[model samples]
Target: MMLFCDISLAARIERAETRLIADSSDASRARRGDTLGFALPYAGGVASFAEPDSPLNKVAGLGFEGVPSPADVDRVERAYAACGAPIQVELSTLADPAVGDLLTGRGYRLVSFENVLGRTLDGFQGEPPPPGVQVRRSGDEEFGPWVDLVVDAFGHADNQGVPSHEDFPRAVVENAIRDMAATGAWRLLALRDGAFAGGASMRVTDGIAQLTGAATAPEHRRRGVQSALLSARLAAAASAGCDLAVVTTQPGSKSQQNAHRQGFSLLYTRAVLVRTA
Candidate 1:
């Protein structure tokens, strides 16, 4: 009997380890005031802050109006400073290029790129988990683990050079949980053989169900836990009247592997462009 298992699994462990250390380092920096809070409510949408005194403001929405002003920036900064978060900024193709130029002028570094991948839920192939494993809707009791898994899956699983998992603070996690519960924005799918081996969360917005927080435990390699959880979410989404499901995955990661196996395809690749503040 060897002290280890599959080589494929060993590679994953190394990736996860690298991811964890990088994430923690980023989080420490964010906690020390290197990043900014970009989630500020405005008329019809949200404006992102790139820095404490950035000239450019980011306004994004599925569908909304109005742009950020200096006054708006001041308001958002004050709120973020009080909340102990960095100012964050966001921009989309729909957003005016002027905003980007403004941020560029102000020396705000842009980062954290991701692809907004989507596919029709119709004819998505897969079956639910095997017997002995269960998927549960989450509540307060399950929030901690859910958040932790999300942090692990994305914030600490890849070699991606992004911020740390610690950037997700109590307020951020709490708000996410509340939103998931209130709008049915998310469904937490837990796979367990009497206990959790892996899980994933799905969120639906405007007929699009987005997948996040898909993870398998260290002890449960190749046990088909993640696949089952994914299948369950797809079935649930189709039943819930979703027209399509979207997911973002790191290039060549295990989740991407699973996605291809389960019938998801690429939509677009978004690069995270960052400049240190």
Candidate 2:
């Protein structure tokens, strides 16, 4: 029946979402600096903390294998509290609505919604980069430049009167790069005329590759730089034996359009819940 098929599809997506979050948490833990990062596992979920001012300091990997109870939620809250940060959780509307109900009952507020998109790589193909554009794996010398390019491309502004990059220290960025490398993730850079034009990063786990932080310099917009990066990353993921590629973007945004054009389908939407300290 159609209902049965829909339920099966939803179940598959839920499983994928859980794996994505857990792998992402592990990736974050691998990137933790001495005093600025931490990841704790509790029943039915995981809590992660990055730089106090960085956007990545929050909890994910929740309700993938089982629905989280109020007690589980409290455990995660305590874990983050020990790190001196407010509790923030990312939940998929499709995975387990019960988890969202539990958080809402506990006074967490929905903060944002992100569209999770994915594509199968059974017959994957990639377009070549634009003329004079070179896509390559980033090295140690490229880490500083990589951070600069990503910050500019994303238009990340200073927060609480601190410089954007200062709030997100270079050390954290370096650790992330190193962590990705250690876990078989690819750190890619796009160069045009020997100048950095864009950057993208991806990590493959259990046959799925997550493409994240794809950004192109403002001056390089509309030049196919992002398209080139996407193509290259997809090709790389396929080569690594990944059967699926996933990305999350603001609903109906330009990024969503790009993903659609590249054959990715909108899988589901997830909202972030926050509880301020």
* Leading candidate by TM-score: 2
Question: Which candidate has the highest lDDT of all?
Answer: 2
- The TM-score values for the models, in the order shown, are 0.61, 0.81
Whole-model lDDT values for every prediction: 0.52, 0.69
Compose the digit string of candidate 1's lDDT tens values, residues 133-248: 77767676777776666545533454434433224544544344333334334656565667756666776555556674576666664677777778788887888888666666
Model 2 has an lDDT value of: 0.69
lDDT digits (tens) for residues 88-189 of candidate 2: 777776656677777788889977777778888876878878898999998868777886787667664212221211235655554544444555557899
**Alpha carbon deviation, residue 37, candidate 2 (Å):** 4.9
For model 1, the stretches where C-alpha displacement exceeds 4 angstroms are 1-39, 47-71, 81-84, 93-95, 128-183, 269-277
Candidate 1 Cα deviation (angstroms), residue 112: 2.9
Stretches > 4 Å off in candidate 2: 1-37, 156-183
